[model samples]
Target: QLHNFCSIELGSFYLDIIKDRLYTMPADSIGRRSAQTAMYHLLQALVRWLAPILSFTAEEIWQHAPASDDSIFLQTWYELPELSSAGALNDADWQRIIELRNWVSRELEVVRNKGEIGAALEARVELWLAPADYDLLQKLGEELRFVLITSDAEVYPLTEKPAEVAEEQLGVAIRVVPLEDAKCGRCWHRRADVGQSAEHPQLCGRCITNLGDGEQRHIA
Candidate 1:
């Protein structure tokens, strides 16, 4: 479980997925702030989990972590936040979403191996999803790209699956296409509105907004 939390949750999802938002965006950006806050909790929890197995190392980390003055011996297991009932995506929904995302990754991999795109964000993914999947993804709207880690993503209800792209597991038909737009210098995502700001020629509109009061973000 600890290995899974470290490899999948922290490495794959949190840090790797939103590396750009965490590093490139301004400190005050809501998305950046949200990522930082989540990381703080994760760090604290992980360190506590390590205390029993790696006592010396965990103690070292605890010194630099929050409540540094307190020793790790005094702390109990980190209590994770309970799943919220406030209209947030539950665990099951996220599991389903991960399955669908894996499907999309396979499609992107095929295109990437062919040298059509250098980065995952260099291509856009379009999905013809089952009714359930479409409804779940539509909740994210444009932010779905963040989850897919793609430059752009479009999800449509599956009317009829395409003959070329075959899939049965998730009932998703995926298409990967190279984006022709200029890539954002900061975010490195290809976007058509990249040069809109006169002051920041290489940034996307979202980055521009983030530079000021920060962009509102609910989920990655």
Candidate 2:
């Protein structure tokens, strides 16, 4: 059965992808998310094909798939009905989004190179897009924002040359700049002037208190 071979192969393949090179696909290819997506689709096709035969195990696997809500058998067939329609699922759209994400990720990598890790996603990105591109990106809202590892983001027309900002080149290219003199002390993110915690004035107040407890525990 498809499941029999796939279950064994997938575990090994996914681990290899993760441990060896999942994050390092050619920058010119689709981004990390697309790599994840391709793996997911491969498994999904295998699961559904096997569900009719393997029954129980396929459902178990499907249940764990992100955003899958129904029984695998009850879900729509793998093939989409809208392929011939005007709004047919387009490969170009997916490629564009993935490319944009890859571009953004490279920019974040530059920040990491500067000895920072885990910047608060919402506070660290400022996207400058051509007018048409800005309009296209705004439609994605926060889902795309998170994919780019920014806590919050806003899209703007590229009116003039961007201010001197750090940049990274992936499939496309992206720029990253430090936010204003804001800082979140607890997490060490660069937005300290937010939320309402006065006790740790330079730190985001929430993390300040949370860290207090963790610090006490560490001391003991």
Candidate 3:
């Protein structure tokens, strides 16, 4: 579970929430501020939790971190927040999502082997699954795209099983295609609106909107 917490939970928070969404947004934007606040608190909890295992490193981190206490040892044992506090999906939901994401990765590998796409970010994915799985994925909303790390994704209900898939794993099928959009100079994600703005032609719509005079925040 610790491995899952570090790799899946915290990893997703850093990649999807902080890097993908917050970093792409303007420093002064409400979304960026909100995400930063959440990240700050989460980091404090993580440092305290890790202190038992990595005392010296944790203390070093705590010294530089903004907190009420001077030392991490002064803090109480770390308590995980409620699952709902982190996301709408529960453990089971996340497991299914992970499985689906793995399937996408395998399919992306096939296309990558053909030299059709170099990066996962340069691929568009199509997911075909049973009605139940489709419903679960739909609950993820826009986050599904971020979870897959693709330029675009679409979920469809399975009709007839495709010939390419084995019988046992017929419940899910994935297709990866090279992304058609120009890559955004700022975020490096392929987007259709990359050249829409004359002022920031190299950036996507989101990047252009978030282009502010203030320095962008970096996760140290």
Best by lDDT: 1
| CA-lDDT, candidates in order | 0.84, 0.53, 0.75
Top candidate (TM-score): 1
Rate residue 39 of model 1 by lDDT: 82
Taking every candidate in turn, the Cα RMSD to the unseen true structure, in Å, is 1.9, 12.6, 4.5
Model 1 whole-model lDDT (C-alpha atoms): 0.84
Give the alpha carbon lDDT tens digit for every residue of 159-189 in model 2: 5436564234321225565565555543434
- Evaluate residue 193 in candidate 3 and report its C-alpha lDDT on the 0 to 100 scale: 93
Provide the lowest-lDDT 10-residue window in model 2: 211-220
- What TM-score quantifies how close candidate 3 is to the native fold? 0.81
Cα lDDT of model 1 by residue, 25-133, tens digit: 6787777877887888888788888999999999999998865667998988778776568988888888888788888888888898999998899999989888999
> Which ten-residue region of model 1 has the weakest summed lDDT?
161-170
The clash count for each model shown is 0, 11, 0
- TM-score per model over all chains: 0.91, 0.45, 0.81
What stretches of model 1 exceed 4 Å from their correct place?
Answer: 160-163, 168-170
Q: What is the model-wide C-alpha lDDT for candidate 2?
A: 0.53
- Candidate 3 lDDT tens digits, 72-188: 898886665544445456668777887788788888888898999998889888887899899999886665767787878888778755667442275787778798899999878
How much does candidate 1 score in TM-score?
A: 0.91
